[model samples]
Target chain A: MQVQAASSSRSAQLPPNDPPGGTHRRAPEKLPRSRRRLAPYGFLLPFLIFFLAIFLVPIGYAIYISFFSTHVSGLGLGPSQTTTAFAGFSNYRQAITNPSFYQGVERVLGFGIVQVPVMLIFATILALVLDSTAARLQRFFRLAFFLPYAIPGVIAAILWSFLYLPGVSPVAGILHSLHFGTVNFLGSHSILWSIANIVTWEYTGFNMLIIYAGLQAIPQSLYEAARLDGASDFQIALRVKLPMIGSSIILTTVFSIIGTLQLFSEPEILRAVTTNISTSYTPNLLAYTAAFSENNTNLAAAIAVLLALGTFILSFGFLRLVQRRSMGVSL
Target chain B: MTLTTPKTPRPPTSEPKPVRYDAKGNRKQRWDRRSVLTTAVLFVVTVYFISPAYWLLISSSKGPSTLYNSAGFWFAKFQFGKNISGLFSYDGGIFSRWLLNTVLYAGVGAILATLLAAAAGYALAKYEFKGREAIFWTILSGVLVPGTALALPLYLLMSKVHLTNTYWSVLIPSIVSPFGVYLARIYATGSIPTEIIEAGRVDGASEFRIFRTISLRIMSPALVTIFLFQFVAIWNNFFLPLVMLSNQKLYPVTLGLYSWDNQYGQAPQLISYVVTGALVSVIPLVIAFLSLQRFWRSGLTAGSIRI
Candidate 1:
């Protein structure tokens, strides 16, 4: 099977060489032409159906509903008294003016700015260490680091919550024994970082694997040449390996940024233990509460639209910034 | 992010080449400052990452009374068996049902997704038709859109069709991975040959048959990688199920555990159950990832590298 595949693939590399079947075909090409035209559509049908229904239509609907509002007259206790109208961006106006929504956005931005770098840095370092010559038991270490990633985010949050609570937390117990005073992991100020720690622990290994793959793809001859140039391992890592894996780092950063904006499962699970995390602690959480708990789908739709727009702009802007910086370096 | 140059032929099956490192250097034995630092860092980070899993193991074995009083990292009593039994027996074995529900959703959803993506990606790679680039880019753009932004809207859409709170609500959305489609296209283009398809066509094989017998066999390695990714994704998914499923019977393990954790205050016994449940739910996927490391590494490379 492998031999046949390899030989056929070799023939494919040749340009339009000798017609298919090479004179073994006595039939007209009409049927083949028609079938070829329709085949791709058949293959694509299932994926496109779900894509349109779940992805595109929802996006369009969110944008559509964001312009409308549901109003109630008098006591407004009955569904009969409720009426929906085209309020013309009134939901957007309301969302913009709401401090809770803005605060959620602000909190997420702060979280991303601090968290993305720390996580990616640790990932890069771990990848470099594992890739280095001194590394031993690479498989075991790699598996150990990545094991946490296999745990679901909600589960990780729960496991870590036990470690965060004062009475059950071994880490807190250790800190108390060391006379560091009692530290509240779920405090209002510390909860975000607590969540950050969960995100970091869950993802650092996964990102390390990505970067390590990048490191693997690098030609070993480059390392040899750098070593011959009197560069130490540290120097080679900094000057050679680090610069070569820039794209990988940037790819992880983009993903981390996007992940930061959609923070939901961790905080939502942690909300059970801590009073610090409100329903509006993050933008996605804010949208969730607005739509479900508060029964304001229109406002939720507006927040979702804005959140999507913010994500697109931030990622696109980061890409542009990186592009411009690289182009400048070349110039 | 280097693309495969035209001159460098890919392996026949497109399985990622085994990891290779130079063995000529005898310098590994040297205990330099950098090596010490690197090893120490690895040790520290490993402990940091594994400490919680270790704690969960120890804590799950303790009864509720000893859970808080005993040292958090050490075992107090052997209640692991009891805790696990309680976890399963609670609410008419609802936790077991949630585990099975997770398997059904993730397994079925990922299988369907891999087939759909493989077919579509193969088509996109081999076919020359109108609006091809337009369709491909539009699908690729779906990768950029955050799922959180879409979850609410998708729920609203599902409710409109009376599909919300059903298995379809979660399974249907989980299967549409734009990123999977992207990876499948790249893999197909690099691995499959046009001449083979042409010859199959000349032999009067239907396109679908050709895909099932020929293309699918050749793409098996890539397919496994794609399926693993989608499986892990759907397995780890919490938000979608949380929003779509209101029925405890329908809850995936993640959401079920969250519900129990929420009720931890009233039913303090649930702490052991939740801890045990978390450990049970995590085992299968962790084993899957560790064993399938090679395939996923290639997947990560394929995703990161520009093709």
Candidate 2:
């Protein structure tokens, strides 16, 4: 009992650490007939090892690397003259103050301020619609809406990018024929929307499925009872359906926030097709350029660490908000 | 919180009060209105949703020279055969190689990752041992961390181990899925009962054997769910592969199309190949989604609501 208490407290302090001394755990009774308890730690061994190496260790390494910088002595004529030193917050300071980094944040903020809500609204509406129907075609819509999400992000971006390319695009051909005036969708003025449309298309369906699942889980008798009370369809959706699925809407919101904070693939891949996207089109993109293009590994690490921190803070805060607002859970 | 007592009848001695919030009648009017509006809206939205892809189908057919000059949103001609010929014959058929590489990357990577995740998930849900919660949280946290955050660190790790540019670099990291494990844990919890395992144990089955025979068979739905998740996750992955491999031979479809599009300003013909390639790329994705539609019903949020 004391060991269990200590382990729980220890988990609070060392979030990544297994409870110390491993003595607290008792196996569940054995499967198929034996009274002997099966050990969970043994079963969990595969995940722990993989998680430690890839997720935990790398996060530690990144934080460690973020504090240092390489200094070149004299005119920096030779490679041997350069030395790595602990630079405290200088790398972080540079990253925070950098023009490229700030611009990436602004651009993404602009994109997120528009994209996240639009996608969520579309998803929530579709889900609510699908929920009302036990109709024959509802399943088809349910599957069709989510089909886009199965397409890989890079492939979706690639597909959309292909459609955006002027000479090779059928849409462009159609616009030309209609005399609608072909403007560059991938151009600087419109690339953000181009990127947003790809994301909205890809994720809207997945979100709809999540929201629909939430809606469907509501007991069928509730709808029948609502009918008994002479409630309108809008009344049930607003009063019961929406409030019941409030938790899921919040989950999607948190996910969208995390995604927006770390936006990379769409903008990064789109960079090749358009001159509008810069080395700093998004925070991840900027961190990438700092690391690979500028060869400022420490600064790059600092930016990456910062970006991760931003994501953690945003998601944690969002989760807390969702919990408090929707279910009153103190996350 | 309905005061539902399916097996129990009203007690003769005393009657319990109905739950205050159980008057679901208040909700009926809204349900009726929502039903009519929702159906009509879905039909219109569904058409809007698929129009772009329809445009893609129509566009990839037109010949390269007239691609920009012709109407693209609607059909002019079917160049499906010619487009493939152009795609395959271009630059000694580099596009075909990229497509092959993609199949290897997404196909193998997703399958392996799914297995790893399923095994890990089963452990978390079914076993009760030391550090079980710790291990579960370690994985759960992974789901929230963006894949972008891992790209640079993973690149450094792969470089240090001399795995960069090899398939292993991309494939190894892919195996540790926080979300996949989360899904698996949820699935395992409901699907694999302790009683069955206890029964298996009474029959003298080993722990792994119990999992293999009883747990695995029961948890097949979750496995398919995890497979689709990993498959979609891996197939769409760009950053890690971009960071790890520079060799053209190692390029997946996404990266290959990206390289082709990057040079479209010079060689306009590359745009046609990229266009054709993009259209075909979505084919497998649509197929993956279609097959996995049923499993998508059980989501992470819904997992919490299962009871």
Would you list the clashing residue pairs of candidate 1? Answer: none
- Tens digit of per-residue lDDT, candidate 1, span A1-331: 3333533553464334344545453443444556767888999999999899889999999999888888776685565466899999889889889899889999999999999999999999999988887676677788899989888888999998888987878899899999999999999999999999999999999899889888877887898888789998789889999987876777788778888999998899888888999999998999999999998999999999998899889987887778786652210
Give the DockQ of candidate 2: 0.31
Error of model 2, residue B137, in angstroms: 1.8
lDDT of each: 0.83, 0.73
Tens digit per residue, CA lDDT, model 2, A208-294: 877876775677677778877998767888887987777677767877887888888888777776789888889898888888898
C-alpha TM-score for every candidate: 0.91, 0.84
Chain B, per-candidate TM-score? 0.90, 0.84
Fraction of true contacts reproduced, model 1? Answer: 0.67
So what's the TM-score on candidate 2? 0.84
Candidate 2 chain B: 10-residue stretch with minimal lDDT: B1-10
- Measured by lDDT, the strongest candidate is 1
Model 2: runs farther than 4 Å from truth?
Answer: A1-38, A72-81, A133-136, A162-189, A328-331, B1-40, B299-307
